[model samples]
Target: MKAAIFFERDGVLNLCETRHGHQVVPLRLEQFKVNPVASVLLHQLKLAGFVLIATTHQPAVARGDLSRNELDLMHMILRRKLPLDDIMLCPHDDASHPCQKPQPGMFLEAAFKWSLDLDRSYIISDKWQDAKAGQVAGCTTVMIRSPWIGDDHHDFVVDDLETAVAKIGLLQNNLYGREVAMA
Candidate 1:
């Protein structure tokens, strides 16, 4: 079984903005600012042979805050900058959409498409919903702590992507070494 890595786009790969006192996902290409450490960590993970998949909840598309084309443009920019193998997005609100995060729909879809071993995969995100979804899907979940989301059901919590990546690297190395020893 091959291991994979899943990431949440908003707040993990890019900056999330607040509108009208409510936190909102980046809805436009201009608003899609890549986190400084995200690119470097992604490159490192790719070099380490981890399949990088982006799983995101883009409710803004369903809410008309952004068009599908705009979302595509933002992803294109991200793909150009980061070493991502695939991107799966759920463009539905949690109340109305069963596929949104905390549901594991996006992660299941990506796992099916990529033929990944969900048990051997890892998910890194800055949201509770993201971590919950990953955990439900049987992946090791890491939550990047933020003020908006409180700690609850996460496998691990870190300050930022850089630290998360380092922890993942250590875990991966230990797992791989143990496998080698068993072999």
Candidate 2:
């Protein structure tokens, strides 16, 4: 099985508007702006043999604020800009919706569908929700410093995506070395 790197969509993979103190995700394709730095940073992880997966919690769709078709268009832009292997999204507001962040459903589902090794996988996000979900899914959690990242149990905290990528690469290499030593 392969290890995957899960990235949060709003802030980590793409740029979002800051509404007051909180970040606001784009509701329409016109408002969407893909982050340029993400391309180079993600390429580093991709070259390291990690499956890049973009994960999101689009509650606006549940509230009838953002349409699924519009979300698809935004995702298309992300795919064109980055080297993502899969895009996993939970378009519901209800707590019962298992795929929502802070719930391990999306990661668990992705692991099952993609034959990923959850223990070896890593999750990168700017929010506490994805970190909590990663914890529950047994994946290493890396948080990028952002106003939205509250007090949470994350494996590593970095100033930028570049630092986070380097951290993950180091961790994966360490794990690989230990496995090789055992063999």
Candidate 3:
């Protein structure tokens, strides 16, 4: 089984606009911009042998504000810029669509599809929904210090993506050291 790193798409991997104090997805392909710092941070995790997956909740599609083609175009740009192995999305507007965030469905689906060891995997996100999902999925959750990350339970809180990646590196190294000691 493989241990994967699940990243939240909006604020973590790319830049988005704020609407009423909430981070909202960009409406057009022209407005989409991938964060350059994400590449270096994710590359470090990739080199450590973790399968990188990006998970997102795009309710705008179901709400009729965003088209699937436009979303696909955005993801295409993301794939070209990031070291992501897969991009998982939930297009539903609510719990009626079980794959949405705060529901472990997307993470669970990724685990099944990628043969992931959920207990050993990690989730890096800037919002509370992803952290909640990660907790239920048995993955360690790391939350970026953002206003979107409300009062939530998380395994680690870091200032930025680089810091989060460093924490993951330490966790991986500590596990490796323990295994070597056991041997």
Q: How close is every model to the real structure, measured as TM-score?
A: 0.90, 0.94, 0.96
Q: Write the per-residue lDDT of candidate 2 for residues 54-102, one digit (tens) a residue.
A: 9999989999999999999999989999999999999988987889889
Q: Give per-residue lDDT, candidate 3, residue 163.
A: 93
lDDT per model vs. reference:
0.83, 0.91, 0.90
Question: 1 or 3: which has the higher lDDT?
Answer: 3
lDDT for residue 88 in candidate 1, whole number 0-100: 85
Candidate with the larger TM-score of 2 and 3: 3
Alpha carbon lDDT of residue 158, candidate 1?
87
**Candidate 1 accuracy as lDDT:** 0.83
For model 3, residues 1-183, the per-residue Cα lDDT tens digits are 999999998888998778798887887898889987998888888898999999988888989999999999999989888889999989888875679889899999999999999999999999998888898999999898899788978899999888999999899889999999999
- Candidate 2 lDDT: 0.91
- Of candidate 1, the 10-residue stretch with the lowest lDDT total is 92-101
- The best candidate by TM-score is 3
Tell me how many clashing residue pairs each candidate has. Answer: 0, 0, 0
Q: Could you give the C-alpha RMSD of every candidate to the true structure, in order shown?
A: 1.9, 1.3, 1.1
